[model samples]
Target: MNGMHRLLWAFLVAAGLAGGLAGCASTSSTPSVGVGPDGKVQNPVQLLGQLPLPPGAAIRAEQSLIIGAGDNWVGRVVLDVGRDFDAAYRFFLETYPAQGWTVVSAVRGKNSFMVMTRQERTATFEMVDGGMLAGSVVSMTMAPRNAAVMVPKKP
Candidate 1:
């Protein structure tokens, strides 16, 4: 009976060691991007960086709008580009803040980014595409408790 007890103890120790080694070996090397409650990426640009973009396309213009109550802000960014929507979107998301902007939420398929704000207001900007294509438009909208308000400028 003593010999059987010793064998079970050895087996438990070996299993524990194997599990620890496996856990260490499975550690992820890729940096973590923002993820939603469901474990899917919450930022589209981050996900775009992981995918391939279209060819010979450039971003032409980008705009952002911020609106909300005090301490509660919603931001929206629109991208105007020539062709490579994916790359342009990623670039705007990764670079715009360097020019003084904050990104709140980013959705890739829709081609837009939401900015968080402390005040209630809307801001917009433009970027020149310079590519052969005439123009492409991308819009982003964010609402903390209600739908975002977007108003088109009169031509």
Candidate 2:
């Protein structure tokens, strides 16, 4: 992680996302994602649903942190995709554009990466090959495009 990544992590942590970070490792039965039993929207589903995810992707909530709401949210979402590095990497390359994200950079390797931007936000995907037992870990970090800009000081 770089300075920007550290800053974003700090922001999310400060925004009270740390509380939601728990229970991601617990397997206890809980309400289904997206909606509660009352039929209202749930937080996890609301946030994760906005992204273009691979089929059967399982979220690793312990390793994820999300802030904001709707289409303007920014944070990191870690997922375990049941595919190899190549397949998982290709999924983003194809799906991001269909969802209006413009691919600015992509690298294919043992640990692949892709950076995409849309509207006022940018997203970076880090795909680490966990191999057969653990599968792949896809860490997607999103932030505002102007979040890190340093305006010139007026003399």
Candidate 3:
């Protein structure tokens, strides 16, 4: 009788452990970003709008740019949206430049956004701190949109 009781107790403990681990694994898995009929990863902004955010969670966009000195030179821009440092960092790395502007480097902290660019000149636009608390920050810097070239005009 004593042996049978011990065996039953051990089995129950094992089953409980397994179930707990499985529950955690499923919860931590990344949410799938389904591909559209066009076979491209769906835009995260649109996706976020559709789903409910985690409790106390908020979303916002941060834009940063660095332009190298010179005409028709390299430029960098980053757009990030997330509270998780790792997720925000990954988002900038995976998204930027591909949209148009070049990307130099991006580093995200629990409450801050950091980036470096070196296309023609280097410039940066980041939140004073990681924008994770409550407020939001957006920044941008670039060459004049209508500046004329310094080259001599042909007769």
Candidate 4:
């Protein structure tokens, strides 16, 4: 694999995504996914429920929110990983798919980005070199897949 690809996987490692790197071998694997026992996945931006982040992931509490929407819940958490860009990038690339998410688009380099979807959930990830601290900043935004679908055109 190329350097970019390796880093994405490293992100998985340093990000503390459960699956091992070997499990990421088949990027083509398509596993079934659905809402958790709570009726829905609390984390829309991540591949699975609130992922177990690396040792130093500090969640920006004031910026996060979980609100009730009818019988469902909507929320987002802004977390920063205390690692270099490569390590965190690799974490998501490998972890998301292993958890049953389909990667829609992925770009790994100085400025990295990943967009993935699973069932009615969609997550957009961005890794930047600088943020609140000296390490890399991982901004993950998640929402319902239907939230961004195009409106049907009139016949």
Best-fitting candidate, measured by TM-score? 2
Q: 2 or 3, which is superior by lDDT? A: 2
Higher-lDDT candidate of 1 and 4: 4
lDDT of candidates 1 onward, in order? 0.41, 0.72, 0.38, 0.59
Number of backbone collisions per candidate = 6, 0, 9, 10
lDDT of 3 by residue, 1-155 (tens): 46543443354345446655765777555345454463333443333222222223332222222222223312232332334444534444555444444565554544444443434433343533345663333232333333333443458
Clash count (model 3, backbone only): 9
User: What is the per-residue lDDT of model 2 for residues 1-155, given as tens digits with 9 covering 90 to 100?
Assistant: 86655666676566446434654555664544464464323355556557767776766665666665456667888887775766778889998898899999988877888899998888999899988877888889887776654333548
- What does the lDDT come to for candidate 1? 0.41
Deviation of model 2 at 38, angstroms: 23
Ranking by lDDT: 2, 4, 1, 3
Q: RMSD to native for every prediction?
A: 23.3, 8.3, 26.1, 15.4
TM-score for each model = 0.28, 0.71, 0.27, 0.55
After superposition, which runs of candidate 1 have C-alpha atoms over 4 Å from their true positions? 1-80, 110-113, 116-135, 139-155
* Per-residue lDDT value at 19 in model 1: 49
lDDT of 4 by residue, 38-132 (tens): 34333343432455454456555455543322213244546667656676777788887888889999997766889998788777887776643
lDDT of 1 by residue, 1-155 (tens): 46543443354345446645765787654344554464333344432332222233322222343232122323443444455555566665656565455665555453244443223422232233334565555443333332233343558
- Residue 13 of model 3, lDDT score: 49
